[model samples]
Target: MQTIGKIASVGAVAVAAAFSLTACGGDDTAAQPAAAPPAPSSSAAQAAQPEGRECTADDVKTTGNFGQAPTITIPDDCDPPKKLITKDLVAGTGSGAKAGQQLSMNYTLVTWSDKQKLDSSFDRGEPFSLHLGAGEVIPGWDQGLVGIKQGGRRLLIIPPDLGYGQGGNGIKANETLVFVTDAVAVPTDKS
Candidate 1:
C-alpha cells in the first residue's frame, strides 16, 4: 500500500489527478471539529441503539460484502439527520485508522432524498485515497471514519452540514448523503 504522499511525491500530474478523483474535496482550511460526536448504531434490522438523533443509518438497508461496492437503499420517507451517523456493518481486525494517515477505500455514494447513485470508486475500478482529516474530503468523512480499521465496512448518513453544504457537482442543495464505505487499506511505507 502506498500513501498519497508517496504517490504525489513521484509526479505533479498524479497529484492533480488524485485530488480531483473524488467528490469529497474541500478547502484545506475546512474546520475540524474538536471531537467526533457519539454515533451508536444497530446491526440487526434497525434494532435499538441510541436515541435523540434525528436520523440513523441503521434503517437504511444495504446488500453487498466488504471490499466491494454496496447497493444502498434509503427509505423513501427517511428524514435527513441533523447530525452525522455511522454504523460499522462489518468490523475489521487491524490497527484503527487515525487522522493524517493515508487511507484507500472503495465507496458508493447515494442521495438520501431521491435514492439516486451519486458516485463510486468501485465503479471506476480504482480505490480512492486521501490524507485523513486534512479537509481533502467532506467533514462527515473526516470525522466519521476516524477509528475504522482496515477491511471494515461502515455506513455513513451525512446531513447537509457535513455533506455538500449547499450542494455541488450534481447534488442539490441541502441534500442528505448516504455512503457505504469499505476501509480497504491504510497505506504504510513498510507495506
Candidate 2:
C-alpha cells in the first residue's frame, strides 16, 4: 500500500508542473498488465440505460469479478471519449462514497490508446488509501470516484482534460485512461 502511494507521489512530482495540484492529496497509481479485450462502443454500452445522458462513443471493456484485478481491453481502432465515463461493474450496498472522506481502494490503470498497464494496487497485493477530493490525486480520480459505494467495482474512462493533461511520468500527452477500481472501504470520522 505504501509502495503504491510512493509511486503515485512520484508521478505527482512529474505532473505538478503542468496541472494544478489541488483537491487531492496524491497522484494516480497503476502498472503494466497484459493486454485484454476490446470494449463496447458508445451506443452499445449505453443504448438501453434509463438515463438520457449522451454517450461518448468509446469501446472500453473489462473482465474479471469484483474484489479482484480486472483485465481491461482496448481496441486497436478505439476512440476515446471527451467526457469522464463511470461504469459500475459491481454495485455495493454500503454507504455511498462522499468527498473529503478517507477512502481505501484497489485499482488497476491502463491506457486507452495502446492498452498499456500503468499502475495497479492489486498487483502489489494491497489497497491504496487517500483522502477523497483532496489534492492527492488527479482531477479524473477526484471527480470520477465520488458516489461509489463500499465494495463496489467501477470502471472510469478518463479523458485527458480530467486526467493528466499533456502527460508526464510515463504517460503520453493527451492520453485517455482506463481505470478499474474497487472501493474497499470508506471510513468516516465519528466525532
Candidate 3:
C-alpha cells in the first residue's frame, strides 16, 4: 500500500508538470528575464510587412489601439498558413523587440478553420508578458514577433508546427492559430 501511494504521488506530479508546460508553450526550457527589444531597421520593417503573397489583407482585418487588443476578423473561407506569417499593421515609433526581453502585450487568439474566438487578454482586463525568443510563448509568437517595435500591432498566422502541433490544447489537433498582438511595453531592465 505504501508503494502504491508513492507511485500515485509521482504520477500526479508528472501530470501537473506536463500541464504547466503545455500552458506556457509546451517547452521544458526556462527563460531568463531581460530588457527591451532592439531598435528597428527600415529594411527589416519592410520585409516583415504583409505583401499579399503568403498572407493577404482580404484574409484578415484588424483595427484598434497600439497597446491594446485589436478586433480581428477572419473570413469563413480563410486559408491557413503552411509557415509562420507576420504582418505589422501599425508600425511602432521605437526600437524593435529583441530576443530574451520580457514583452508586455495585449492579444486575441482565434482559430482559422472556423474563425472561432479562443482567447483574449483584453477580456481579462490585463495584458500578459512573455520572454521574447526564449520559447516562453509559442514558436510562432517567438519567431513572428522578432522585428516588432514597441507600441506596434501585428497579426500572426501560426501553422501547426509552430503552434500546438499534433497534440493540441483541447481546441483541436494540428490547429492553426491567428493572433492580433500589441507590444505594449518592453521594460529596459537588463538586471
- With a 3 Å backbone cut-off (N, CA, C), the pairs that clash in candidate 1 are none
Query: CA lDDT of 119 in candidate 3?
Result: 74
Candidates 2 and 3, the one with greater lDDT: 2
Tens digits of per-residue lDDT, candidate 3, 47-140, equal 4444444445447887787766577787544346688778888897577788988887777777665467777777766676667765455567
Candidate 1's C-alpha runs over 4 A off are 1-53, 187-191
Clashing pairs in 3: 37-98
Ranking by lDDT: 2, 1, 3
Could you tell which candidate, 1 or 3, scores higher by lDDT?
A: 1
Residue 27 lDDT, candidate 1, scale 0-100 = 39
Q: What is candidate 2's lDDT per residue for 32-78, written digit by digit as tens?
A: 22243457578656632334333342466789887878888865443
Q: Each model's C-alpha lDDT?
A: 0.65, 0.67, 0.60
lDDT of 1: 0.65
The candidate 3 region of ten consecutive residues with least summed lDDT is: 1-10
TM-score list, all predictions: 0.71, 0.71, 0.67
